[model samples]
Target: MTNVQLGAPNFRIVSTNVSGEASSRALFGVSYGLGMAATQFALIPLDDERTLYKAAISALWTRFETENGVAEGRKLALVNVRYDSESINTFFYTKVTTVVVADVVEFE
Candidate 1:
């Protein structure tokens, strides 16, 4: 149970309940394996940060699909994704790259 103050005279209350079996194991806790890939953009004019991020993620997923067998229409899923970005500044422009690492999981 909780109370949220929206404004000076407005308020809202919320409540939530959860129940689960003790023997049930969490899905995210189980990691079949992990894969990592990097995408680089050098002297490329990108529309925005969102576009850059999307491109980086797409490249990582494509690598996984091609080499790691995480192809399309598969029951496997990627979770707990982590990534790092690096940029190199030069006299004329900057080169940016991102490395993504994620754990793979398969559904029963």
Candidate 2:
């Protein structure tokens, strides 16, 4: 694997995660703004569902660094952080598979 440096003060780092829920809700929100109020009701449930997925993704990142011997303070240039999630269960409200990746670039 190629090492990519991450962390430069000049540029802002942005991260995003895409899921079925987010996509559907985002579309609904956009449509609602365009005079499609009916979609908003369907999208509300998605908003709640996505929050749990987001939390899981965050925890996964925290655990990744801990398990991979990566120190949080280490200065590395990372760009284009992305994450994806999928539901694994419906009953009992416990199901999500999250995958995250980032471009690590050398800053110094």
Candidate 3:
């Protein structure tokens, strides 16, 4: 149980429960061995969807982390990006992009 300090009105602290269903999903993907990574696409509606964002995300990871500890034959592929729209405030909106990274047995 990790305690996270999220500053608030009363300066309340919250515990991070990774065992919850929400956090559990982050542990795996389509297949146990498949790799994935993701990031937010835009603040404005670039209208980026999962199918379109996959290629960009994959390229970004490879170019930046080609020398990672992964094996020679194992490369990171852009599995998909999760797009979410959140209404944090009445006058403004937030679009969250979650990039998923995974290790692959085969290279494309």
Candidate 4:
């Protein structure tokens, strides 16, 4: 029998949803690993929550890329994204801190 060797995967999984429900099912042979981040922001009551949430995710992705030295064209995939946040109320504004932990994968 000939020995078969497997190479790197051609694709990766990146999802913002839990349960992998909104992601493509196409199979990839390999994966990187998980990444976690804590992002904080101070906002007045009028600040947009949705926008900040999106920013937090973006920051997390940036952090992953910087730490991993991932190539520019390479894509970052996040799955099983678990998010938690805490709010500290102050006299002038609220400080919101978020922690995001996910199954992070890097692929071409």
> How accurate locally, in lDDT, is each candidate?
0.43, 0.40, 0.31, 0.46
**Once superposed on the true structure, which residue ranges of model 1 sit more than 4 Å away at CA?**
1-50
Ranked by TM-score from best down, the candidates are 1, 4, 2, 3
Tens digits of per-residue lDDT for model 3, 1-90: 635333644331111111100111111122121123322322344343544235444544554345444333543232223332221222
User: For every model shown, what is its TM-score relative to the native structure?
Assistant: 0.47, 0.32, 0.26, 0.46
Tens digits of per-residue lDDT, candidate 2, 1-108, equal 765433545434332231122322332222222221112323223344444335544564565455444636755444565555543323223233345556443233
Model 4 worst lDDT window (10 residues): 19-28
lDDT of 4 by residue, 1-108 (tens): 533232856555543332211111112121111233323333323434434446666677666666566536765556577766554544454444555666666554
> After superposition, which runs of candidate 2 have C-alpha atoms over 4 Å from their true positions?
1-73, 90-93
State which candidate has the highest TM-score: 1
lDDT of 1 by residue, 1-108 (tens): 634333563322111111111111111122111223323333444334433446655666666656556456755545566665554545445445555566555443
Q: State model 3's lDDT.
A: 0.31
Instruction: Select the stronger candidate by TM-score from 3 and 4.
Output: 4
Q: Is candidate 1 or candidate 4 better by lDDT?
A: 4
Clashes of each: 0, 12, 12, 0
